[model samples]
Target: MEDRSVRRQLSLLQTSFLLIYIYRNDSCRSTQFASTEGTTSARLPPVSKFGTVKVSGNSMLPAYRDGDSLFVSWVDGASALSAVGKSIIGKAVVIEREERPGIFLVKRVKNFQDGNYWVEGDGPGSTDSRTWGWVKPDEIIGVVLFRYKKAKPLVSE
Candidate 1:
């Protein structure tokens, strides 16, 4: 999955509100940039909720490296709780870490059982459910639909 080609292709899907800034550390303060500011012309299907996630670590390496930008379809606490294992299982999600409160973590949903979601990072030695245990559905912020890594040069037709 080292190919940045897939990221370049998916980067075409976008929306105004989906623009976001990347951070290099857990600290929220950092230089900001808009993902949709002339990089893409694609449009997201008219949906009520959508947002972006910027990778600052290698936890999801291979599928999503550091600096990769992900366009997510946001699912609020209420909707996520009701959906349970139906919509989120087997999908990559941005979740509010219960331990860190406002901090968010991106991981793939591995399973749902006993009112909790088993999420894990794609890379070995990555910290996730293996260390924190299952996450509540309400903790899930969104599900990833498309990714755009800025480092990948877009291929013009």
Candidate 2:
């Protein structure tokens, strides 16, 4: 009876995890997301906005601290291509790692060469295009719009 109970609990836990995974992936790939404070863009509609992603490491240390959630939006290649020298250069973006499927990294755009982008993190600890070489546009998820950080005290006495 105890073994059966344990098995049931495990099944429920697995189901919960699966659901969460699906939801996260769906939100990441699609432009749609819940109407949340940090997720929505002030100037654009939610449908044409970026998804939120939480920082997990110190790669972007000074620019972005760990645990800070940022709004990342998919880039419109048409518009970017229309304007030369304005595709993704000098922008911070969230890119999908080609080496490891489903893994995403947030880095700044250094340059554009051929049809690929050179991305690097603000901090020296980052292992970005410097190590992986150029990243294809398809691998880039979107540009980071803004960061949502906890507000500091209004009057720190």
**In the order shown, what is each candidate's alpha-carbon RMSD?**
10.3, 15.3
Q: Residue 74 in candidate 1 has what lDDT?
A: 70
Worst 10 residues of 2 by lDDT: 34-43
Which residue pairs come into collision in candidate 2? 50-73
lDDT of 1 by residue, 61-122 (tens): 77887677786777775565565565667778877765665456778899878878888988
- Colliding pairs, model 1: none
TM-score per prediction, in order, is: 0.64, 0.60
- Candidate 2 stretches with Cα past 4 Å from truth are 1-48, 76-87, 150-157
Instruction: TM-score for candidate 2, please give it.
Output: 0.60
Could you tally the backbone clashes for each prediction? 0, 1
* Number of clashes found in candidate 1: 0
